[model samples]
Target: MTTRISAVPRPAPAVDLAVPFADCHITSDAQAAVLRVLQSGWVTTGREVAAFETEFAAAVGAEYAVAVSSCTQGIELALRSLGLPPGSLVLSSTMTFCGAVQAIMHAGHQPVLVDVDPATGLPTPATVRTAVQAFGRPAALTVVHWAGDVADVPALAEAAGVPLDHVVVDAAHALGTYAGDAPVGSGPGATCFSFYATKNLPLGEGGMITTDDAARADWLRKARLHGMTADAWRRYLPGGSWRYNVADAGLKANMTDIQAAMGRAQLTHFPSWQRRRAQIAAQYDEQLAGLPGVGLPHRPAPGQGTHAWHLYPIRLRLNGGIDRDEVIAALSERAIGTSVHFIPVHRLAYFSQAALIPSAGLTGADALFGQLLSLPMYPRLSGAQVDAVCAAITGIAHQGISGKGTE
Candidate 1:
């Protein structure tokens, strides 16, 4: 039986407006899609999920795509499928979400943090070389498409002296990102994408792993569903039997049909959303240009690749009179929310253990961490909100400092 809920109305706040750093766009079609799934009675990984996987694979130009519960699980499943020996070293960026390092560790590997490019907060070919030169050859590397800017995969592989197959891309922020003539997932390595609430293609909470390797694809299919030879839908089909076989012990990381329905709806509307995001990014670039002591996010020249515009991370000149935290507080006071993209992985208490990641060599990451701040960015963010955000920032730059800047 369905329970009826009563509506509750509240008075508006005293502030002009409250602008969040990011917001999900849930279309009417998305709501209907979820309702259809709920009415279908088959809410697990079934027809809806199968269709989403197929359509998503085609969109990303990949041979196969496996939907998972989250990008973190997708990364772990990809790494586990590699069959790497225990204690294998996985080189990853220092300026990235904890999910990457946690995935490496969960997949029975040790994470060696690599410094990022000081300008863009991304790991470069030189960063890979430095990691290899310092830590010796890693069994695999987990490269992030930092803030949706495509990494130079070929150059990075050559520098690391590893084949392209040894790399797994954490493209959590890169759904519409392109690398040359191909999409981000249409490469030699496994690519993981997030559908978190704040991500480009928000599905509330889900992820996908795409790869061209048929063997790995097949393995991941089974690995995401408890290593069963056949999924529940397949077994329950008309001519199918309930019998199945266990291949290997796998984690439970399958995406439900309800989530897939939401994803499918979002996919249909993705192009328009992407276009709006790009437009907003352009406005930020034009309006926020040459603001004293502020560095805009790095954008690639035309034909190099396309950025997904997942974040607009601006660097605060820490040595300048204003401080990053003070700026954040000032913006908050103006009813706008800002966030820091990351704290260097080396500084985190768990990862700080000398055994996991040595802290001495992460000079670039450490330096970038103190300066980075993520401005409000999302498809639905209005021109007026963007204007107010910029004005608040400019005002803070003028008079936000109370004393010498905090390093």
Candidate 2:
């Protein structure tokens, strides 16, 4: 039998949740790992951080991994490491976080916005080619893997006429995401992953860059820690040297051992966490499949690799007299939180006047922006909670059809 919200609206059950759009899942082991770091005396970037890097690199099939303070910093460092000339142009999707564009500016380059595919909310090879045609060839292409869906970086680079090494993947939403047979980070160019509180790997605050380039990895390591030859662990440990040199001026974006310890512990449970995420996404797919004026998220094809399901975004068909904001407010009344993935970069204040190569028209991104609505998604969410969320949506959708829409 199909679940439905009661017309009488019964009292809230004990398990009834004010479900937030995102929630951090912290295990006992993760807490213990943090405690161990607190008692270890050396809590800065040290053995724990080093070990985390090695293990993370192996997990993603990358030759090297450099941990940083945030994904934004990782993107900046990755861009700077490229040794691209000043004032160079970089191509990126308009339907992405502002940080990705800011990173290009931080690296002393200009950003050229490309329209995304409305269905996937990611820039396609055709879009990349069109952007390049409009604003000369870019020095690099920064592809944002939107909502845990991996973008075809190789094809996008080829379309942009940029080398594979010149491709930088803003994979902040993609941790468990895969590309073909290999993981996302294993692919060409520098791929950045976020370990924020809401991310797949919840380290509270940290990011990592994975790449196969040894020279770039070495540069990133020093660049993340003020270009110092040795970090605190190398200088303060027994039988270590105090003499150090600053090879280049760099930002202080090093990840602490405390975060790294938590990350290591989180990594141990990551596989199971990923499986749970997939299960939750499947439940959403089945439950919300045929609702009128409700558009489900795009599914990946056979060889496109698996989606990480970071954000379960659905589109509202506005022509059916349904307002996205109204739906959000109704869901809020039911104590179910929701969000919008992003507003196009061009629409933002800073970016509107910034030195960005404006696209002819961000048709796809513009269309998708109006209807985008992200539902609650997290590993700890119960099946009943999922059903409740779906039932609430179904009721609202039916109400719209009957001319009783939430206005």
Candidate 3:
């Protein structure tokens, strides 16, 4: 029996085309929460934000959580909170989103790009040691949990010869990620998470910074709100003191009550959504495995770690004469959306001049960049849609090295 996928009808194939690379998962509950917040008079960083901070911190096994406008700001705030001297070196992954490096720069640190492991496309302890050898002791090291897979933070910290506190995790894709028995933010380093529209637990545009240090958490609270000793919610509320002073020259990046309301609702239903994401990934793995030159998202063996499955990225084997761009175009023509995870930071115009702290060339990053493609992976994506996506990928793979459809 042939399974039919329900999607917008297209003129050519008689099958509806256009599957987005990613979509926001907002249920009626989420919608109601947002509406309630809108109706409530206290709409800016009030009860909803406070509740979200508390709940999210507990959920991630962190001592404290500070809500912010975006993960980029959270990264910058975490860096600034360290009070590193100007021009201090900060080793960062070359394979991450540009915002990670930009945050380091915004915090007045010089970023030294480091290579990533070819298999997982994440920086390993060996890479950290290599970077430390090439560059002197960095004031800090920023590691990204690429594609929601937890990086070996403890080992990397040890290799960098830095205390765990000196390591900052760019966990933008790893809200539910775990390492061994602990969650991503449960570790010693500051873990920053994103709530972007396309993220796993998005609230349109917000972020959270989770850490174990009480002092740092307190400082970040002030720093996120223009360095004010007290936020407006406190001042405007009854019996609250209006006499407050600026603590630090902080950036305006506080999360609003509206965003937090949506976040709160999403957090409540996160477990089920997460399970669906894992299921979709497993389905893709089962169907797409052994397709000529195509690669699928990697999963750790049981008891190893938990992958958040934020993005299901596949690599096209260049040796098979697969042109990634051409395949992307073919998918697009079929109404299947796709994207590249990232172009290496060193290759970007902004970071082109950045020095690479390498024992070897950035060949690993470059190699990964050449073939990586992100497929749609969201909780709302139906099983039939998953099948359609897999079918499309399989069809493309069977087209042979020439990229000509076998049909």
Candidate 4:
């Protein structure tokens, strides 16, 4: 039987919008998983860590999943393993988080900034081509399922060429997202996933690296644990001796058994949690589409695939005398929690001329940033909450611009 979210009617204009956007739902199973790890007495990397790696790899259709301390480390190792030379162009969208840019620089690479589609703040294959031309190389591109629209990676790869090196995906938002039947990491190249507390899969602060290449996987394993050859042997095996070689100067970036324990539990509940996310998204689709100047998140084209709905952001048009920031503040006044998905990396202090991200101008990125707003979207959000959100949006919108373009 298809599970459908019930209809959430618009609330009266006087009532406080009782619905907030997101709430993380952790089950007793998650507690049990953690307890098992505690009782095992091995809190650091151990059997639980290995099990997490195995299960996560299988979930994303990757040959290997190396658990790491954070998504930054995952991205950092992915770049180091891709064998891209120093200062090679690492292309990423300015429409994403600053961490993506910061991680590339940390891995000793130059960030080639790509602009996003004005309509959706997504870097399409063509936009990537523009950035590549500016850099004059087969630059490393980080594909984002920005707001869960899986960019055309197949066409992107075909046009860019196969055996594509340095194509690391910042799949922080793409755990359950699918392109046809294939998830983000299922495609060519390495993919990084975050298990940040707010992510669909919460493990407090953890991450995983996905790759199909055995040699590359091995190197990442070493790099993620301080570039030493003895991590698995010295720490994991008893009486195996501590003598082992160091590959390179690495960092302490390994995920603990405790964190992996949570990952294992999340995997168990993700199926139902993901279904709830889908049902909630479906309701948003029907309700938000009717509101003016409110452009809802994009869905995959027919046969394109499924979206994980990591965020439920709506772009409110600003041509109507009211600014996007004004709408957000008004929502806050009405007890609705909202956020901007990003501030567009190009606008950051790091990238503002000091860093100099290439674009004819930052025209495309700045345009998109002015209108975006991320509504709450965690699995625990109730149907009643969804209705309150919709009502607050409509109310704030009408008061701001009358749901019609500014006169």
In lDDT terms, how accurate is model 4? 0.77
lDDT by residue for model 4 over 143-222, one digit each (tens)? 67787667776565544443454578788888898889888787568889998887889888899988888888888888
Comparison by TM-score, 1 against 4, better one: 1
Candidate 2 per-residue C-alpha lDDT over 20-123 given as tens digits, one digit per residue, 9 for 90 to 100: 67888788998999899999898999999999999999999999999999999999999999889998999989999999899999989999999999988999
What are the Cα lDDT values of the candidates?
0.84, 0.88, 0.85, 0.77
Q: Model 2 lDDT vs. the true structure?
A: 0.88
Candidate 2's C-alpha runs over 4 A off are: 1-17, 318-320, 355-359, 405-407
Find the 10 residues in a row with the least total lDDT in model 2.
1-10
lDDT of 3 by residue, 114-137 (tens): 888777898887777778888887
RMSD of 3: 4.5
Runs of candidate 4 with Cα error greater than 4 angstroms are: 1-21, 157-162, 232-236, 318-320, 354-356, 401-407
* Reference-based TM-score, model 4: 0.90
Per-residue alpha-carbon lDDT of candidate 1 for residues 32-62, written as tens digits (9 for 90 to 100):
9999999988999999989999999999999
What is candidate 1's CA lDDT for residue 102? Answer: 92
lDDT of 4 at 88: 71
Winning candidate number (lDDT):
2
